[model samples]
Target: MMFDAWLTFAVIAGAVYLFVTEKLPIEVVALLVLASLLALRLVSTEEALSGFSSPATITVAAMFVLSAGLQRGGSLYRLGELLAQIRRGWLLALAMMLLTALVSGFINNTAAVAVFLPLVIAATVANRQPPSKYLIALSYAGQFGGVCTLIGTSTNLLVDSLARQSGEAGFTLFEFAPMGVIFVAVGVAYMMVARRFLLPDLGIPEQSDTGHAGRYVVELLVGEKSPAIGRRGSELLPDDAGDVVMLEIFRAKQPVSSPRGEQVQAGDRLLMRGEWRDIEQARKKLRLDYDHVARDLDGDVAAERLHAEAMVAPGSHLIGHTLAEVRFGHTYRVRVQGLHRHRLAIRQPLDRVPLAVGDVLLLDAPEKSLAAMRSDPGLLVLGERVQERTKLGRALLAIGVMTGVVTVAALGWLPIVAAAIFGCIALVMLNVLKTEDAYRAIDWRVIMLLAGVLPMGIALQNSGAAAWIAGIAVDLVGGYGPVVALLTIYLLTTILTEVMSNNASAALVVPIAIATAETLGLDSKPFLVAVAFAASTSFLTPIGYQTNTMVYTAGGYRFTDFVKVGLPLNAIFLVMAGLLIPRYFPFS
Candidate 1:
């Protein structure tokens, strides 16, 4: 039975690695584990599915909806605006990071990151700095700040719930505050000092003549008389387009990649990436007439659409509505040539999909629509026009609702799950987020990943895999006593986080941490803290945390970028956590 437990543990570890490395979607990996456990008779079907019903899962799902509301209400954008106004150079950046970290200590870190990313990007751009410099800092700050409060991240909640299940006193929302505050301060200081030395001086110009380069809706257009007309697009633009990158091309209203070598037609639109001058020069040199008829191409001519990009505004009656519902072409007199959300291409049909906050809507509409959009109170026309209005009332309302939920949960007036759900409902009722758009805001991928990986955590404990691992842990650190054992657990959990989802890492390590505490006959709080802190501090690899991935492409950073900065930060936190955790919850 013990050997079987060891074997099961090995399987779980392998599955976790495969999932973290994205070899398979996390849900598929989780399902695979469920199937294997049942096949081995380690758990019944009911047991395998138990994780789906856990309060942690429900709370996380509800939180996603609540986050969606905050985003839709423009609360995040407002916050970004404030952060952008800070005038002090690196000091201001440090202050923003500290505030971000402090806020993340109470909310979901990923949600926190999502809320702040756009703002951070805007702030960096405003300061004439490379976004790559500050974006990673914000991500790291959020992860570190989450370690400060149990409610800050799903990983902390998982550890707390698992500890309760193991007959230990679960942590309170603020229980980790003391050590967390210290760690946050230290981490922020380190970032402030390192910003000058470690970060590359991209010397980003103060004003990008590209003028809000993000909103350009530039596409490719192949001419009938061109040398490359009938040839496959792939042949015309090899996988690599050399200097000029083709974003997309339209043939008969259908998008075809240059990689596919699809033959180009007379009126095919080609979406290309180049500076304004370069694009203009290319147009002249190629002798290709511009498709001024394309709404996206010709829209906002007054502002000179340097790069073809578009923007979406809140409260435009477009919120909570899909492109299909808007009859985009007929009603808005615009056709969505392409969509970019979070810097990724959206290949799906625009009509069937609902828009989320931060989504960049690419429209082939008359240039006048840009001015009209700018006039709408709920809309913001990026690049061409900057319209600022006081949405303070709406922003405050969102903050109040979110605060109420946290207060209610803390006072035990309602369960955390109920509180979060109610908060989401209130936001929708207040029109902060439309009821129809609520579901679209929730990231189903993350929810599914959490639900699927949870059962594996349960299987580890039920099958005695946790105990088997704990026993090995005990012997390995036996000479050093409980303190050493605790350190080992923290180190192991930290390593796991670098290779897997933080939530998944927490779930996997909590059981073993508790089991080890039991074996040592010491208080479990220290071990639990170790697991929670370790799980949230996955800075070593971009794959370890979603925020890291969010900045990866945007920053043009390689994997080593994370390693170069994050590895040292990882070690710093590990030492700080190891020393502080035991002091708060001594191993007597």
Candidate 2:
């Protein structure tokens, strides 16, 4: 028993360390933990594999499919367009955050951010403000909004699932809403205040010109018998050149997206855009002749090619793959000239930089193909193409399915697992989402993490480690009563969540919280809710929540930015949870 206790503690400690450092993927670490526990006989195979069949894991997986269905239906795009129309400023920031929170309450927070990201960029540009002011708020709103519903995040579901496994009633669909509403209100107010003082103004120069004046769009002609002839378009540019992006290539009088693998020919007309200084330097660096008359020749030339701006969609196939690897140019018949992510310009080796979901690409393609571009579903064409088509019928059906899931689950007509799984099947059956896409929609890493860590919790219980720790914790704070013990659970969970994944934190601490409450001869509801809330309130750092990390790079924010803005909010949550949990979930 002693050896088992020490081994369990060491495994948990190592898991925490790996989660913090993130040397490997979180799922990999989770699997490692599961494998170690099984190999060491700490947990049997049946116990270790139980999480895969757990209601929480299934529900979370189903939610991902539901979220993906919504995304594919183009509902999120419409929301973004509506938000972009709002007048830009503090009011806009507040509204964006509120709307983001509201939408995220039902759907995945990451999807909310992914859908609204480009819209926020447009809002900032229209408002003539740096994205730094609003992007972090967007991230925070998603986090805060997630706490509003049991399905708002995987953390709540995990806690509720564990509670049920411990023989307590699971959370109702709206059970989290009352306290969650307060958290969202406080978080929004704090972020609005932070925007004025704490957020940095990342240098995004205001657009003074009406028609791409600050940017240079130059047409370069490949010289006959030149050194660049017969090489791929991507090979023509220097590997380190970050200055120029290829917008369009009039090859044999045709235009395409990314010319990554296309062999460059003499007399090929390349239309590129970048900073004038960078372009000028790049022009000299790459042997090319300027096409002065090509600008005028456009009047006489066939209308086969055109230049446009496109925002990479959230679930784009292009994401995480390099242009060259994806044959981006060949596939789309488009030449990518410039790229922007999170409202900031990206520097070269454009072909090598893996594309992210929200990146905005400047592409040159055939004018006729622009209409067909909507078929890609991965790239959302901005401006004129904003009215791109979607299957409204399918989208409406998807929304109805999600609503039905909530209604059934809320009414207790079915368990959340049953409702959610049914919703997923409906999505696939009604053709709202493809079966393959449904599978892709589920984040396997999260599944693995939950499946792996659940056994550790079981081991803790079976080995009496949880009760042992609970006894120590309660004894240390029992003299102060249940309030202190509850707060300790909340605070510790919150701190751990800041450094590791929230789902992991909940899995580790929820059992301890339950044991602590039982040891005190108190109802465990308040303590359990405290763990759920604390695990979800990871505001102090970007690494705490997936949505926070989504915006960190896109917003061009430093680690301290989250601290500077989210620290106060964390404190506010701490006080609120401490006060409200006991009221709503008494410790009798």
lDDT of each: 0.67, 0.78
Q: Candidate 1's residue-wise lDDT over 1-588, tens digit each?
A: 776677677778788778666666665676777778778777778876766776777777777677665655566666656777886678667867887897786566766775566556556667667766676788888887887766788787777767776678887667888888888888888877666667555444333333232323355456767655676655554432334445556667767655355666778776665434455455555555544454543445565332223444322346456866876555545555544454444443345556643445544455565556544433333333343343777778878988898889878788777888889889888887777677765555556666667766677888788888888888889568887888888889888888776777787888888889888888888988888888878888877776676555344456777888888888888788768888887887
lDDT, candidate 2, 328-426, per-residue tens: 766666666655554234333456667765565666677655677755556666433444345789879988999999999889999888999999999
Off by over 4 Å in 2: 205-391
TM-score against truth, every candidate? 0.78, 0.78
